[model samples]
Target: MSTGVSTSTDKIIVDKSRGHRNKAVSKAVRQTRERLQSGHASSSAFDRDVLQMYVTAVLQGAAIMPLFVIIVAALGTYFAEDASLLFWALLTLTCHTANILLARHARTKEITAEAARRWRNLLLAGQFLIGCCWAVFALQDCAACEPSSFTLYKGATLLIALSVTTMSNFMLTPAVLVGFAPAVVALAARSGLSRDILELSLAGVFTVTVVFFNYISDRLFQFSLKILSFQSEKDDLIAELEVAKSMSDEARRRAEEANLAKSRFLASMSHELRTPLNAILGFSEVMSAEVMGPLANPTYKEYAGDIHRSGQHLLDLINEILDLSRIEAGKYELSEEAVSLLDITEDCIGMVQLRARAKNITIHDQVERQLPAIWADEKSMRQVVLNLLSNAVKFTPQGGEINVKVGWTAGGGQYISIRDNGPGIPEDEIPVVLSAFGQGSIAIKSAEQGTGLGLPIVQAILAKHDGQFILKSRLREGTEVIAILPAKRVLQSIPAVEQARPVAKKRRSFA
Candidate 1:
């Protein structure tokens, strides 16, 4: 039973090892495919950035190496001879100066892929030479040196050199390996020449450390590649957004120009169009009334009346279109006045009462008495009331009730509300009703099709007065439209009778 248990454990371990090996092979294959595909693309920018980072690292090492060399030279027991110490110092200084100059030159050069490759080679060569100079210390015989001192000196120098190169070149895996391989080889060779068990063991440990650092360098390289790729994608997205914004601005500008042209055309032709329309309406009315002479046939009179009505309707439509165009073009100028809301509402009610009576629709009005006058354009205010009442009468069913109310608002403003019980607009079609030349689905199916500019004109006029217009409706229920004049537009004043009775009230005694 114990043998069988051991066999099962061995099988599990073997399976795990095989799984790891397969995973590694798969990863290597995917990486190779990616490299082959990416090789065709231009990597100039990536190369430039990598080269810049490399130059920076090289410059930093040049600054730090001279200090390290000085410290090592001061601590070494064999370097008491002035000539030998000076030779070592000069060699180290020369290598450092050459590397500094090379780094500076590389930094100033425009980096292409070829240029980056050349710089990498030059950098690795400089590192190799610097490593050789340090290795000479390991090769030097210190006759007065204790075994402990010699070991300490060699280990410290090699470890410090390894740390510096590893940190500097870790961004590029191949560069790191090439730059530090010489130093690793030198240390291992020196250890073997010493023929000491402890030294050989230390050398093996150093080689293993170098391999571990190389692994870390490869990981850092992959991380940097991912970061760079992400940055590239971010830059592309920003460019696309900028392009979209520019296109939107251009489209908006073109639309404004086209709208301006249309407004100008309408303004220019208004007189020409209205003159013909006025003549047609005038002549048709005269013929229908038989003012000049009796018509030859009764049917001719009826046709003439029809012509007059059609002409009048056309003129009203043209006027509405012109008004909407002016408002959109920012050309509508308000003729300001103090207009009584009650009086305007009454006039509008009287104007539309005939149409409501034709449909047998009862018009109910609830207006607050002595409502304050509003500062507004009188003609515009009249148009606003007429449009609302017209829409209510048009949409209200036969024998249905229409409610018109004018009163003070909760915010100390004046408002007019017109409601009708009819085939009310659907909620989704409300926006359509509000837009110019847009009608609800029900309106489209009705026998009376409107020009659809009435509500938009009313909205525009109210907006010009710094007021708000609200329309609320639910399908098959009812529609309510409200026009509100802002509080600032409400005039503060006393009526003539009230002002005249002030002296009489002052003379009266308190009851």
Candidate 2:
């Protein structure tokens, strides 16, 4: 029983020992893998960790290369006097070559992502080369040094340290960060833990932070500028669209107004042509009646005369229509000549006297004895006066007065005026009456027959003469129409050839 128990205990102990050994082997394997990875990540030329490692290496190499060289020389002196100078010369050459390599790689390039990365790679390679050379020198020096004595740099080590400082400081931060990291790490490790290493580490951290911040700021500013430019272009397009819309609206309004004017003109012209035809037809039917006897019946003879007169009146209306149409179509021009204003006014009144007498209205003429001759178309001016007198006689009530006045106005113009006691026009409706085919509001409600083209003709005629028509009217009191024209003397090349003649001496006269 004792042997069995002892065998079981031995078996258990052996199994436990094997398990412990396995774990120990596993841990050792893991540690070795971790060390290899760390070494490569930190010291490899292409690795990001090289920046820290390289900077450490540089400071440490600088602080201790002087001591290492001294120790190597001392050992050489003790073993072989001639060999010390040979080794020293070889060390100097190696240090200078590494520095030159570093300097050659650290040049400015175009700023871009790919270029920045390439810069980092180049700097790292340069730093790694420099560090490796210094490491080899340090190892060799330490190998020859005494255990108890401290070593300092010789002339060769001093040169290496100075060259590295120049390269690291002169290179831009992005390049320097990648190149100087390995040097810094090595320097920290080998420099006996000095304050100089701490200062250098802080400097490294600050430089890298500033460089990254500046790069980010530049990118943000570029993005903002692009956004502002796009917005400005958008605003300009919107303004152009608004202007186009406004122009389109204005053109549409003008087209509509032109169409409306065309429709109104057509309607008025149709009415004018039909009105004269009705009178012609009515008068012709009456004249054709022979029931009252043709040769000797006075009543029948008067009826025939009335028919003839009506036919002539219709012909006159037709002729006026043609004249108005020609003027409106921009074809009529004034045949200017010296005209007698007094004679024109008297003829107009004589023509409309029968119509005024039928309404029992009184006609009065007020003329300065002899008026100055005016520059006007004699026939057109006579028609203007006749139209005014006829209109006054038509509207005036029985026993009401129609007054005709003609003279040279005090304000340097010739004027012919017709005044009547009649229902007058409203202020707001006056302007509309002056328009073609437009008439007064009162005319719309009355039994009066008008073609609505009279005033338009009057206005057209005055415009051709370069003259003005003035209307003064008050509701229920009276109305006055004035035709003002530039005096004819202004156009005369001869100074009133008959100025002293008795015919021209008087200021006003009758026809």
Candidate 3:
């Protein structure tokens, strides 16, 4: 029974050992494959980036190598036989010079797949040759040296070689191995030749250290490759973003050019178009009034009146188009002056009153009394008031009421609001109504269709004055349009005490 238990325990231990061995083998194989792949992979942009980095490291190391060589030569002269000092110094200098030339050459060349492989191989070869130089120094006998002095010299040389190679060439794992393998083998062989337990143990420890360094180098290479890949992707994304921004800028410039061209075309044709239009209106009016002679048929006078009205409407549309074009082209220069808002509002109301009366629409004017005058363009302000009133009159049904108010805003700005209780615009269609040549469904189906320029022109003019225009409407309820002039445009009044006093005696003297 005891034997059976022991057998079972042994089997279990064997199974665990086998599993561990398999795992170690798998790990080793994976690491080997990775190293091989990294060494022989075809060059891409990323590979070039890695090569560039490697060259930079080499250049930096080249600078330090000469200093190291000088220090080692000094030490050898001071502590031991100086016989081989010149030979070692010359070899070190030559190796460093060669490495510098190679690194610079690699930097100058545009790396391709085949070229990259060749460069890497050359770099590895250079490193190996340099390692052999150090190895030759380390392997040389120092019979004149004391035991402690010899130990110190050997240890220093080996440490320097390992550290330099490990740090400078770690980004390329294969390069690290090739560069330091000779030095490590030479040191191990030298240590073993002593046949002392401590020396052999030291050699074993160094071998382990070399393996550790190689492992670290491999990991570092992978990490550096990942970082470079991420940087490349980031560069690509930045390039694409720059391209998109340039295209958007170009499109914007083209659109502006097209708009300018349309404005120029319209401006050029204005005089020619208005000349015929004025003639048509003038002749139609004279015939309708029968000022020269009586018409042969009474119907002829009515036809002339219709022709005159149509011509007038066409003239108004043309004028609206021209004004809108000028505004869009940034050519509408404001002629600034002190103007009374109340006066302008009254004039606009008078102009639209006849039309409002035809529809039986009631216009309620609620203007503030003794309102301050504003610094603004007189003609533009008049047009703004007129456009708002006309829109109200046009949209309001018979017997519907419109409220027009001119008052001070909360911000001390002056505002004119015109509201109509008629078939208001749909909320979704408000933007359409405000755009140039845009009309809502309700406005389209109405008895009268405007040129759709009134609101847009008003909005543009307000914007030019650094003011704001707001339109609010709801379907089947009402619509309100407000034009606000900023407080900065409000002209301050003189003090009452500053007024000139009347002369009381002037009237008596005249009598």
Q: Best-fitting candidate, measured by lDDT?
A: 3
In terms of lDDT, model 1 sits at 0.78
The lDDT per prediction is 0.78, 0.59, 0.80
Decreasing TM-score order of the candidates: 1, 3, 2
Residue-level lDDT tens digits of model 3 in 450-493? 69999999999999999999999999998999999999999878
Clashing pairs in 3: none
Superposition TM-score, candidate 1 onto the true structure: 0.77
Model 2, 1-511: lDDT tens digits are 1212344533443343334544554565555445444432211222232333334444444535445545656655564334544465466546645644443433222234335455556554654554454444433333454422322332234234534443433223333334334444544454444444433443354345434543553454344345544554455446545545555665565555454444445445546665766676666555655444454666766777677666666656666666676786577777878877888888888888887888899998889865667778988888788778877887787899988888777767778889998888888888887776677877667526556667778877887888889989888887899988875333434465555555655578779
Which regions of candidate 1 are displaced past 4 Å?
Answer: 1-45, 56-63, 66-109, 166-176, 193-242, 494-511
Candidate 2 has an lDDT of 0.59
Q: How close is every model to the real structure, measured as TM-score?
A: 0.77, 0.45, 0.77
Estimate, for each residue in 1-511, the C-alpha lDDT of model 1 and write its tens digit: 1222354534443343334544554565555455444533334457767668768877776667788777777766344343465577679779878878988988887878666777777877876777667666655555666665677667777777677767777754565566556656766787778787757766787778777877887787667766776676565556555555555665565576567556656765677688899999999999999999999999999999999999999899889989998898888999998889899999999999999999999999898998978899999999999998988888898999999999999999999999999899999999999999999989888737668998999999999999999999989998999999999999989557645444443576789
Between candidates 1 and 2, which one is better according to lDDT? 1
